[model samples]
Target: MQIRDLPYADPGVPDVRSGTRFLLWLGRQQLGGQVKCLLWGLLHHLGIAGLPLGVGLAVQAVVDRDGGRLALAGVLLLALGAAIAAGDVMLHRTAVTNWITAAARVQQLLSRKTAELGSVLTRRVAAGEVVAVSTGDVERIGWFVEALSRFAAAAVTLVVICVGLVVYQPALGVVVAAGIPVLALAVLPLLPHAARRADVQREKAGKATELASDTVAGLRVLRGIGGEELFLGRYRAASQEVRRAAVHSARMWALIAAIQVVLPGLLLIAVVAYGTKLALDGRIEVGELVTVYSAVALTHHALRNFEEIAQAFSFSRPSAKRAARVLSLTRTTTTVPKPREVEAGGDLYDPLTGLRAPAGLFTAVVCGDPDVAGRLADRLGGHPTEPDADHTSVLLGGVPLDELPLEDARTVVLVQDKEPVLLSGTLRELLDVPTSGKVRAEHALAAAQCDDVLDALAQASVATGGDPMLTRITERGRSLSGGQRQRLALARSLFADPEVLVLDEPTSAVDAHTEAAVATWIAELRRTRTTVVLTSSPLVLDRAHCVVLVHEGQAVAVGSHRGLLATEPRYRAVVTRETDEELATADGRAVELDALEGESA
Candidate 1:
C-alpha cells in the first residue's frame, strides 16, 4: 500500500497497532504498484536464476562434444546475459519506488502527528527525538518496505534453483539441499544479538540527540547563569556515551557480517566436495555438478538479503515505537463540541468548577503555584483534554466552554502568556499577531502602553518586504529587551480584543511605573469586556474588580484585593513585600553605599 493511503486520523494520538494497520491498509491502496513490483522483481530474479542453467547446458553440450549443440549453447548464453541485464535494471527501479513511497507515507504520518499535538509535542517528547524519527526512522522503515519485494524474489529464486538442482542430478542435488538449510539457519542465532545492539544504539542516539537539543535551546540561559561550560561538559559526556553505544552496535554487526561470509564459503566448500565425489563415482555428470555448484554460489547473495532485512527491521521497530509514543498523547482537558457564539458581551463561567470571571470586569487570579494558573489559562482557552476531571471550564454567558468549536473558542478567548512568542518578522508583524488587519493596531497598542515600543520600532526602521527600515526580529524576539518584548506581546493580545482576555503575568518584565500604567489602562480599556489577569504584582492586582486567591491549586478566597489583604495572611504577606519594595524605592535616601564603594576604591 502506498504511504499516501495510510490512515492518519488524530496524528498525535499514535496507536502502534493502528499505525501497523494503517501501513497494511496503505498496501491495499496501491495494490497495483505492489503487484507490478512483485511481478517485476520475480521476473528479474528468475531471469538471473536462468543464467546458471544456461551455463550448465553449455557445459553439458561441450562435455558431449557436439559442435551444433555448442553453437546453440552460445546463443542461449547470449540471451541469458541480456535477460539478466534487463532484470537487474527493472529490479533496482521497482525496489527504489517501493522505498520512496514507504518513506513518503511515514513522513506524512509524522507531519500529521506534529500538527495534531502542536505545542504539547515538545512538552512530551524532545525536539531531537522528533528529528531522529524523521530522518533515521523513516529511512529504516522504507528499507523494510523495499526489502519485502526483494525478499519475495529471493525466496522464489531459491526455490527455482533448489528444484533445478534436484531435477538435474539427484546426487549433487542432495548436497545442495543439505547445505541450503545450514546457510539459512546459521544466521538466526546471531540475529537476536544484532537486533538487541541495534535497538540499544538507536535509543542512545535519541537520548544524545535530545540532550543536544535541550542544551542548544537553553544555551542563552546557561550563558546568562555562567553554566555554559558545565552544560557543555555534560553534553560531551552524553556524546561519549553515544559513541560507546555505536561502537558496541557496530561490533555486533561486524560479527554478523563475518559469519555471513564464513558460513557461505563453508557451504560452497561442502557442496563442491560432495559434488566432486559424486561425479568421480559416476553418480552425477561433471556438467550437472558445475550447475549445482554455481546455484549454491549464487544463493549466497540471496541469503545475505535475509540478514539485511533482519538488521533493517531491528532499526525500524524502535523508530515506529518512538513515533507512536508521540502520537498517543490525548488532551487530558476536555471541552464541549460546537461552542455557541456568545452575545459579544457576557461573563465567562466555568460551570464544573463553579468559577466565574464576571463580565466586563477586570478579574484577577492569584495562584500560589503559577503552573496551576498556566494550566487554568490553557483550559480556559479550550485546549483539548479529558472530560472526567473535577474542573469545570470558564464559560461565556450561559453556554458551556466545551461546546465551542476549537477555532471559535480561540477567537472569543485570547490567552496572552507571560513570555509570548515573537515570531521572526517586522515589528509591525509582531504588533499585528494573528493579524488579519481586523483590529485597529493603534488602539490596542495605546491600551497596552506600547507607545515606546512603537517608537523604537519606527526608530529602528522595522518594516516588511525590502525596506531596510524593517528590522527582522530574531527568533523569539531576542534582539529586543525583555521589557520591550513583553510590551509587544501585550500589544498583540490587545489587538485580538476577544470577548474574554486571559493575561498571564503580562507586565512582569516591565518596570513598576510601566506596570502600573498598563494595569490602569487595561482596566479602563477593557471596562466593557471580560478580562482575567493571572499575576502576583500588586500594581496589577490592586486594579482588578475581583481577586481570587488560589492556595494549593484551588480558589479558597474570592474578594477584592483589599478585602483579601484584610482577611488572608498569605495574601497580606505577599502584598506587604511588594508594598515594602515600593516604599524603599520611594524613600530616595542612600546609606553611603556608593561612599563606602568610593572609599574602598
Candidate 2:
C-alpha cells in the first residue's frame, strides 16, 4: 500500500477492513508489473505445450513421404523452442521485480510508522517484533504478491492448451481437463491446517528472538546478581519451544509437498492409461495419440506451479498481517499537544504527582521508591506515554507540560541520570555533544569535574571519529566505569544548559569524595537557575536549598536537609543509612554549611 494511506489502515485482524485491504492496496500499486509477468508466463507455458504437437506433426509429415512438410515442421519446432526460452527469461525477470517492489513498499510504510511513533515504538511493541517485521516478513509478503500474477498466468495458459487439444482431439482434451482440476484441488484441504501451524511456528520464533534480545541487554545486570544461569536456562527452554513449533510446521508442509507430487502423478497415470485404451480402439491415430499423451505431461508441469502458489500464499498472508499491525500503530490517537498561550515566567508544575519546581530555585526530590522516580523522569522528558499509563500535568510557568511543543519542552527541561551514556568518543567530544554552541565544552567539563576523566581517556588512547581525542566507543561504552559514564552524561546535559535541569542521583555511582565534590560544583553552577535533583544520597541532598521527600508517589515533606532531619522522621530515615551517625559525630562536631550556600550566591 502507499505510505500515505498506511496511517488510516486498521490492524484488528480477521476482518476484511484491515490486513486484507492493505495487501490488496499493495497489489494494486504494481498492477502493471503483475500484468507483464502474467503475459510472459502464458507465452512460456504455450511454448512448452506446443512442443509435443510439433513433434506429432513432424512424424505425420515424415510418414506421408513429404520432405517439404517435414522441413517446415522442423522450422516451426525451432521457432517454438526459441519463443519458450525467451518467455522463460522474461517471466523470471518480471516476477522477481514485482516481488522486490512489493517488499520495498511495505518497508517504506513500516519506516514511516516508526518515524511517526518515535520513542513510543518500544513501549508499544517488542523490539524483536520490529526486527522480524523489517526482515523476514517483508520478503514473504513480496513473494505472495508476485505469486498472484503468476498464478493467473499459469491457469490461463493451462486453459488455452486444453481448449486447443479438444479441438484437435476432443477425447484427449476432456481427459486432461478432468485431471487438472483434481491435481489443483488436492492441496486446498491441507492449506488451512498448514497455515494454522505456520502461524504458531512464527509466533514461537518471535518469542525466541525477544528472549535472546532481552537476555543480551540484561547480561550485565544478570551477572551482577548471579542470575545469569537462571536467565540462560529460561532462554534455552524458549529456544526448545521454538524448535518444537518448527518441527510441527515442517511436518505439515512436508505432507502437503508429498500430496503435491503424488496427486499430479495420479493424473499422469490416468492420462497414459486412458490414452492407451483409445489408441487400441483405433479412434485416434498413433501420431495424435502420442500428441495427446505429450499434452498430458505438459499439463502436469503447469499444475505443479499451482502448488508453489499455494505455499507462497500460505506464508505471505500471515506476514502481511504482521506488517499491517506495525503500520496500524501510527493511527493511534494518543499524542501530547502544546498550549496556545503561556506565561513567560512561572514554576514548572506536575499535576499527576502534585509536584512543582519553583522558578530559579534548587529543589531536591527524594523518592523512597526509585521505580516511581524513574517513571516520573521519563514522563518529564516528553517521551511517549506508556500503555494504561498514569501521568500528572507537568506545567512550565503554569502551562501544562503536554501543551508545550515537544521541541520547546525539551529545550526547557533536561533529565540527567547517574548512569549517563558515554557514546564512543573522546572526553572532549562527549562534553561537546548536542554540539550546540550554547554551552562550551570546557565550561561543561569544568562544572562536572571531568578533568580526571579526560586524563583517563588519554591514557587509554580512546578515539571515536578517528580523531585521537574523538575516537569511537564500542557498543554502550563498555570501556568506561560506572562513575566515568555518569560524569560524562552529566557533562553533556550541562552543555545543553536548559532552563530546568533534572538530575536523578547524578553522583550515586561515584566515590564519596567525588560525590561531595560534584554535588558542590553542581550547586555552584546551578545557582539562581531552576534545578530539580531526584536523589537519595546524603551528599547531593546536603547541597539543595530545599529538599522534598516523596513517599509512595506523593510529596510527604518539604524543607532543607537539616530542617527535614529535625522535623520529618520519614525524610531522616530515607536519606541517612545510619540515623545515629549524625548523632554519634554531633558532640563538638558542628560544621557550618553556610559557606557552601554563600559560594552558590
Global lDDT of model 1: 0.73
Clashes of each: 28, 11
Please estimate how well model 2 matches the true structure, expressed as its whole-model Cα lDDT. 0.75
Q: Hey, what RMSD does candidate 1 come out at?
A: 7.8
Q: TM per model?
A: 0.81, 0.76
C-alpha lDDT of residue 428 in model 1:
66
Model 2 earns a TM-score of 0.76
Q: What is candidate 2's CA lDDT for residue 556? A: 69
Candidate 1 residue spans exceeding 4 A from truth: 1-14, 17-36, 62-101, 333-347, 351-353, 359-362, 384-416, 423-437, 441-470, 495-500, 520-530, 543-545, 566-568, 575-601
lDDT of 1 at 152: 69
Q: For residues 275-325, could you state the per-residue lDDT of candidate 1 as single tens digits?
A: 788788888777777777777777877787777877776777777677666
* lDDT (Cα, tens digit) per residue for candidate 2, span 1-601: 2323443243222222466676777777778888898899888888988988888878878778789888988998999999899999999988888877788777777776775555457667898888888998899988988888888987987888778888989987887777777777888988898888888888888888888877886777888999999988998998899899889988988988788788767777887788889889988777787787787777766877787787787777777788778886732334555344455457866666677778787888888777677666655554435532554456778776567765566567777644555656555555554434656777777777777777766666633433335554555567767777788778788777778888878877789888888888777776756888888888888888888888876776888888888767677767775456655464224333555667789
